[model samples]
Target: MKIQLLVLFLSTVISAFKITDGTLKSSKQELGFFESDSLRLNSTEENLSVSFKIKSNTKPNQIFVKLTNENGIESSFKPTTKKSGESYISKLSLPFTKLPTLFQASSKLFVSLVIASEEDKYFETVGSIENTPYLISKSTYKPTEKFQAKPEIHHIFNEAPQTVDPSIAVVFSFLSIMTFFTLIVSWGFNGALNFGNFKFDLSHFAFIALIIGYEVTFFFYYLGDSIFTTIGRVAILTGPTVWFGSRLLNYLGELRVAGQR
Candidate 1:
């Protein structure tokens, strides 16, 4: 009789529970309950809380709860005990920063738990994060205000080649300023410069156009998300820089020849 009773007791003890259903809610709304082995989390502007309920089983203290990702990353937490009517549940805030960066912003995360009162060992479960809404992805961003949503733009650049350095912008600006001053000095020498008998002031217009083109091209291309942007940046900047440099040299040569004559 003792042996039979012991076998029955062991059989009745649920060695583990399968994560059956999950519910998520934000401050404004319930995102809707989902049936999943893994909890889908979203990185949204709203604070999200998710709770997972197990199959019909006697609820224990659930003294230990830790979440792990596919990468073996882990975060341990103690959920506040609660009963929703008759059902037992444990709640974990989604995208928990409470623990060491529990899940990467948009990657799949696995879960692990142990009811210390019921068992001594922690075991892995099918439970995982399903979605990350506020995950800082490029697909779901809108720039409403004056480039207010810069992070979305920045994320695009992160996936691409390095942007133009600050030094490049500084160098270009200096070159533009110096070029304008040199043009003024050259105009004083030539009494208004001309090109090929067109009798138009090419110096002023060409210098301003090249400078504007250089700044605008590099600014956007540096923030772009393409391999070609990097390659094209070199080609683009070369055109304006070479044009300005050669034009300045040609102007100086003309003044020198006129002085010799």
Candidate 2:
């Protein structure tokens, strides 16, 4: 009787791990997507790879892969399966050049995998391992070492100016012109022609001096060598000067108008 019991226990253990029943299997845990760029020109023509696995008795009938951005633009890859007995591998070749135009710095790409026809469908996200909520880089392409640097001109000024708001521009232009004319009338050209006994004060002289200094610094900052560094230094020194000068001039003009009345 004891021998029979031992035999039964062994049989149960063996059946628990029996491969023929397809119970000892692995499910598709996750997917991986990667890219290779040959030219490395920051263009989209790189090679991409997507990998996934299945560990159940059921085989996936179809798989779909897609790349999308925050703007809802999408690119799809249709995979062809190659079977080696019970194991299957599906692959798709995608060109980066064909990616959506909306894919930009602020955009994201989603790589989703679907195992169609499975009673319990499996889904997984595959892409950059950075764990960022957004996909900022391409994963389906490899970068090549061709070393095509972006033109300096493009970085400097190639980007289109943001669409101007006509109303805002018109308002600002009118204000700037009005302020300029008011300053000229209040101070007079070189303070030589005064409308009344209102002589120019030290504050008025200081305001004019600072404004001239700011304009000179701004011009030099733009036209000088090491423009970025020069601009940084000039802005720090001149920004407050210009702000104070403008405010003082406006305040004095207001006082003059009040006195006139």
RMSD of each: 23.6, 25.8
Q: Model 2 misses residue 154 by how many Å?
A: 30
lDDT against the true structure, per candidate, is 0.55, 0.50
Candidate 1, superposed: residue stretches over 4 Å from native: 1-46, 53-61, 83-87, 95-99, 118-124, 130-261
Worst 10 residues of 1 by lDDT: 4-13
lDDT of 2 at 261: 24
Please give, for residues 1-261, the per-residue lDDT of candidate 2 as tens digits.
445323322322211111111110112122324222111223333444554444444556656665544444455676775554565566655444455434434233545455555354544334421112233354343434686876666346577778789999999999999998888787775785655645566666666777676677767766764777766766775766777677776776887898852
Q: Which stretch of 10 consecutive residues in model 2 shows the poorest summed lDDT?
A: 17-26
Which portions of model 2 show Cα errors greater than 4 Å? 1-41, 56-58, 104-106, 128-261
- Candidate 1 lDDT over residue span 58-164, tens digit each: 66655445555554545667766566655567776643443344344436644445553454222434345544545535223243477453554433444666679
Residue 210's lDDT within candidate 1 is: 69
Clash number by candidate, in order: 13, 17
RMSD of 2: 25.8
lDDT of 1: 0.55
Candidate with maximal TM-score: 1
